[model samples]
Target: MKWEKLGLVCTADRFGVDVPTRVMVPTPVFVNEDTIRVFVTVCDKDNIGRPYYVDVDARDPRKVLRLSERPVMDVGTAPSFDEHGVVVAQVLKTRDGKLQMYYSGFERFRDVRYKIFTGLATSSNNGESFQRVKTTPILGGSDYESTFRCAPFVIEFEDRFSMWYVAGSSWETIRGKQVPRYSLKYLESPDGIEWPVEGRSCMELQHDEHGFGRPWIEIDEHGTYHLYYSIRVCSLAAYRLGYATSEDGLNWVRKDAEMGLEPTPGSFDSNGLSYSAIIEAHGSTYCFYNGNDFGREGFAVSKLIK
Candidate 1:
């Protein structure tokens, strides 16, 4: 199957909105038959992050993305976890009539010292609001003393929840140094909170010219699993998308699509594309990825015509 550009759906400068100062990562999901829900992380100059939900009609071309009056979730003092900040959430409907949102959080005080963790929240109503689960830090720091854990992606398979998240050491140093290694790992949960996994790095960076991180997964119509991740060597600007496939969730094999998607000749995405989120709806597959060195978010659609 071939993918085609669907033009820019959401940009920083659209609808009289200010250009997002930090970064905009979108998680697009099909809420129902005629509506699509997009949860975006808006990072401002102050470095404070907020979650916004936008609902758009599936059939409208000149559609306006409507933001929810109130944020679905935010960083607050909960005593147990996530007092710093919350961002980049992946929402899914569980079997028991509840919405599960697996998100990444950072302790503001600890984040100043470079520490991060993952948290979970749930909503009975379809994303109108959410409540923090009693269990916190489903996945925490590793034995390596990794500094941060963020960017979680969740999927349900065989009555269980599977998650892939980014984990790495501190980019800053104790005195004056730089650490440049990041990786993606996998964990499993039955209740979307308690992940009991050992010290196992599901996917790590090989000592090669290209580095790998930011992994996202989607199961195709024929039950084939596709994984899209970021490959960066030096700077974040020199990043590209990579692809892999798996029959089962655990074992994966790399594919030939080394540069999964790149820039067009005369387009805004002429720089690069990464942070990919994919959803298959109505017999068509859509990939929503950020563009232009994380300047804006764009989308591309392709049909599984094979």
Candidate 2:
């Protein structure tokens, strides 16, 4: 219910890439009992993103262990769904012992600002490298979700795979700039690869909220779902963390006031907080999140206190 902030862990400079200016989205997964590999995306000078990772000490995540030498995978060639770039969202180990990486693929368009879709890659030899399952997005555009269908967080069950992702068909102009309007949607796939054309509506935008970022679901011992996501506040031109609870993972009860996480004034996350992911290691619950301007100051961690 509350958290103790751990400040910034690692940034783009740690990778020693002159082209990358910012590190975005911290998707942390435990490689072992002592190592936490934080999968992230680094943006080039033109703002195109590529997925990389930073390994940190599980006991003290502020201590960086290693930085990935190259991107997990390269951007797609021209005319592909991920021709522009990719941002890693979540990585899960398959029943067959391979790593399944789900990410958001970025594509630029002249009509709108951009289009984002979900893509998948697989790493057979641990998390060192990956190969795209296909050139096109596994969850691409549909009639209902025409513009965006990205930021996917999936949980694989024995019988099915359940996903909570951001989806929308429209864009709105706010503050004289075009912005995509999206909300949470749910889908069920027999396998992690194939999915339906459209997803069942879960959470819709309310009040000044224009979009929802990544959906991170945590199931308690009793099987109650706690969904944590970021709301794109149109009026403020920034993001704020949102929380909700669900019994069946389809319907949700909004409880933003109880989220207990907020921006730290005069700090890296002073203006905006976005792209949050939760993981439990060594009996401690940790939340990894991004800061202002989509993590220009890199990602940080917070330990759950209550």
Candidate 3:
């Protein structure tokens, strides 16, 4: 779809980070009638990953009022896995009034390439404090899988919970060497615990000479589902976001410029922007996406002019 640029509402500046160096992926949420909360992955000067929460009053959306006193979550426990780092993703408020977080965990070890997994955490006090689910590592290695799972986006559909995550072969071939080039896959859970990947696991979008992966999807109130994903334009040595739509949440159709909301130039996002988290508010749509080579998170607003 072709999206008309409507200026940036928030930039990396809000976190005191310099472009091309620091990176931040923000997941926004409407906490209440008066508050908006953004959960971000904050890296220290030493590049250690930590979780930070920034809150703003819905009344004055421009002013950030509170930041967490300490990293709400971080790497803990060792040898088992996920001992190296952890990063936060979109937080969801369950039907039972509990807050659930879907996050990625990274572990390091010799003889093993790397391990990435999805974990679940819950909060009872409206997100102030959280406890990891007892049945942890909710999503991990398949019997024949390797490498890891990362960048999970989850949402409730109808009465079921669904997630789209980046998955790839544990092996890769690069310049006379082999490595893993991760791609995206889809899974669903009835209760957000035991997830089973769909038969059609990967996106079938035509590639742009490089490859494609990292999908973020959203279903609007009207039941229309939209997916925004990243694809590398090898000739340009850059990544770009592409759009597709599905009414049944399975088969999808790529929309062209003639359809509306095509890519635009200018702004911090002109270079590379993908992994878009989209939400609709006050009758308009806002997309929060990583910008400029996935080094920082920025937002762009569009009126869904289609």
What overall lDDT goes with each candidate model?
A: 0.63, 0.90, 0.62
**Candidate 1 per-residue lDDT over residues 30-66, each given as its tens digit:** 6777777776665555555556666765554125457
Q: Find the 10 residues in a row with the least total lDDT in model 3.
A: 14-23
lDDT accuracy of residue 60 in candidate 1: 42
lDDT of 2 by residue, 128-199 (tens): 988999889999998889889999999989899999999999989889988899989999999989999999
Compared with the true structure, what per-residue lDDT tens digits does model 3 show for residues 1-306?
A: 445555454554455533323345666677786667767666555454556667755544445678766666666577644566567766888878888878877776676556777788888877776778843477777654455676777877568888877665455444444444555567777888778633246565355333454566777679887777666555455566677788876666765233343345765666776555555555555555556655454444444455
Which scores greater on TM-score, model 2 or model 3?
2
Worst 10 residues of 1 by lDDT: 297-306
Candidate 1 residue pairs in clash (backbone atoms < 3 Å): none
Distance from true location, Cα of 15 in model 1, Å: 8.8
What is the number of backbone collisions in each predicted candidate, taken in the order shown?
A: 0, 1, 9
For each candidate, C-alpha RMSD in Å?
Answer: 3.9, 0.9, 4.0
Off by over 4 Å in 2: none
- Clash count in backbone of candidate 2: 1
Off by over 4 Å in 3: 1-21, 57-63, 110-113, 134-136, 157-159, 171-180, 197-199, 208-214, 256-267, 296-306
Which candidate wins on TM-score?
2
